[model samples]
Target: MERENAPVGPGDVVALVDGSFFMHRTYHLAASGDPARNLRPSDGFPNGAIRKFCERLLGFLEAGFGGTRPSHLGIFFDHSRRSHRSELFPGYKANRPEPPADLEALKPLFRDAVRAFGYGCIEAENYEADDLIATYATAASARGAHVLMVGSDKDLLQLVGPTVFAFDFEYGVPGRSGYRPARLFDAAAVAAAWEGTPPERLGDVLALMGDQTDNVPGVPGIGMKTAAKLVAEYGDLETLLANADAIKQPGRRDALLAHAETARLSRRLVELERNAPMPVPLDDLLLGWPDPDVLFPFVNAMEFSWLGRKLGQLYQVEASSYPSDPRFAAPVAGSGAAGLQALRYDAVLPAEGAPPFASDTAHCAVSAMPLSMAHIDGWLRFDFRSPDLRAEPGQGHEGWKIHVSVDPGRVAAAWDAILPIVAEARLQAKVAGPALAGRLGDSSHRQAGKMLVLYAETAPDVGRWRAVLTRVEEALDKAGVTPGPRVAGDR
Candidate 1:
């Protein structure tokens, strides 16, 4: 969520997943035929279901989650068969068969997998993930965050609007074997899919057609084409029912007139309850770096070596491998990127006029060191003059995004250290005037002096330097990487 006055910028990204749909899709599609036949873990449990889900989920993650690289990611599961829709109509989804044993068995593992990736999971007793996904998507859209509903379920199509898109990760590009490309569906795509009827009328279209899968009884003998035409002409089911007698064809008009209530019931069944209460804060769902501990072991056990390889590259810390490296042995030889070995580096603030201890000084000057953290005490110090700026492809030259680390325990301490430096930068920027200062949201400020200045947590507050400590704290908890104990909490 955002502040009441937040302006809708390019907006942050969020992905809402439909867990129930994934379970069945992955279980059946991972293998050639048998549901139980696929890669099994060391424990001999069938993992095809989970494996397929992982592969598809990774595509979303790898693609920066439909190119938004969502800061908050969520997967929602339906724990119960009953839902508000089913309660309203007992025959809702009555024709659907029981889920496959293998698919049903993978729910717990799926939940664990989602968590292992530093993402949140949601569940409700009498609400389907579909409804919850729609709720979150709608809320995110209204709040000005771009939402990607990561599922192929048709029910989600209606939710596609400004700030809310349906990214069907399982969509096949056709004739491209082993190449299921993720397709981004906007309002235009939704309208096109239903043949000229916009997403707003999806419920009405479905109501008249009557979802045979869900056993929703529409007016008898009204086919999909007929229903779509009626919805397009009438705007909605209620309008269509009210003006049924106007239809040129008496047969279809009579059917609509006779079963007006049935059409009404069907529309209610497909309509998404976008206001359903969410179980967790929407902000907490942003995807962060997955925990290496949980991710690596889980992938290995699932026999997803491909994913393991990617994680290994992305998460590798060479410091563990380069003990007594020659680069460290001689400062003269360690200045270049060729022999650069990542070591667990820590630099405490030295006393004024004190010499920098006899060790590597000029080595590896050019780098993009994530402000992973800083503090009030001299425990850590960063020099703004020698920032290691690196170009991130497609991210443009937003140097402010240079900081990536989140240390929960010492947010206060970090701010304390940054306050004076940031304050001086602000003052200098003001003295230089807006013409000299770089942009700060809608205004301009002297940014050169404030190289160390950071962004605020919300959009309205962006470009303004303030503590986003809560977001940082939540990020730590999500990554399972807690910061060390602080002096205040130590006692």
Candidate 2:
């Protein structure tokens, strides 16, 4: 039979994902079960594999449609071992090993990561995700939408047809290696390899052979080639059993006749349950890029360093808002009061014998990278007056300007503490600025006093400065240092 060209058109495509099975395979291969390496401290389990799997999945989705937007998509996962398949076979997947303890602990993190991408995860008790996919794939095909069942599982091939196709996201075209789309078990293709019998009869073929992988015991000595031959000659296990004596090989024939009942049971086990109950609707599977805020945090936590840049690009394209760049003024070399090339962005206190105007002599040095300047807000400065200076009848004007700089490493910590205060102040300025102006507040406090001058060009991006100020205030409060009256200015 001639192969058809790849499906074309920009029509709606629904991806019925097998999350649990894929994740199980990935986690087994990737996650190192070391508790110390786990990012989430609450649960001491590591999820390195899940993180990698998610990144790959994201990459696949982004590249699959040649950058064309997908129409509908939803992920389905198996709940647990109490599935109906287990009930039917009693030994279904029982041979599989339990997940590592660390992996088991990271299950919630994996679930959260998937949900963060805005994909719904469905897992019903006692029903496998494969069953749900089969049911949904059939339902979706009936609705006139193309269905792409994303998985490596062969059982899914049974659901493939004109509208439904199974893509093995494991082996396909070069870059599209993971996407394998095949029409439901090609009868003609299987027959060419198996010598006349179609793939639809593979269940019957397997029943006679017994799948050792699934631990089902077929007639003891009969192997795959013999099984395929018998099914091809006799049409099916039932027909082959009726004419058991017609078998050419005495030993293989005796094995088939003696274990005929076992073959029938294995066939039943291999058939997919097409009528499984699935509540997911085709309309509910709206697909698009993931939300940035939700997606980035998980990406960061997972330590997907390479994906961070990709995420930033995707976010810029999808988000309504963009991060702004901070502007900085040119710095004057060796011009600070201390003759230092770099000046700290902070507040300074006045000292004895210091000229009231001496603080103005202190120079502000700007950063070459304006974005970096926004991080150094709330630096302190101190001016000292001469000992001979008097309070009431002040005489001496001798003083030293003390410039305080904050630790760059602690900027984020400081910013986190102070952001709420700055936000609150901004809100107040918006809501009660006029009301406060008319209330006759302390005029002296607002006049020529030592003020914290933030040299960053963009005040809105100065979150780190605000945070530093918060930390400084907390330290001052603890140290019993009463801050003198001051003003704040931003350039």
- In order, the Cα lDDT scores of the candidates are 0.57, 0.52
- Candidate achieving the largest lDDT: 1
Compared with the true structure, what per-residue lDDT tens digits does model 1 show for residues 1-491? 21112232256777788877777777667755575456453334566667777776676577755456765678887755667887889988878887653453354567667755756768765688889998888778877788889878787888888778888764545688776766888999987778777777887888888888778887799877788888888878888788889998989988888899888888888888888878767766756566665566566656565666666677774222322222112222112224322311223323444443322233322122122124211122222111222112363223332232223333334333333332222111101112111221122222222212242222322212222333333334544653432222111
Candidate 1: worst 10 consecutive residues by lDDT?
426-435
Q: Which stretches of candidate 2 lie over 4 Å from their true place?
A: 1-11, 31-45, 65-70, 170-197, 300-305, 317-491
Model 2: per-residue lDDT, tens digit, 1-491? 11112232336777787887667767755644553443323322244566566775685557753333346776777665446667767787778766554454345445666766767666555677888888777777777778877776656665666667665544345557455443333344445545455556766766777766566666788777888788877788789888997788899778877888877777777777778766545566676567665666666555554666677776654222333111101111111225331222222212323322223221221221111234522223221112221122345322322112223233223333332332222210011011122221243433222322222212232323333344347543434445433333311
Cα deviation at 38, candidate 1, in Å, is 2.0
Please state the error at residue 184 of candidate 2 in Å. 11
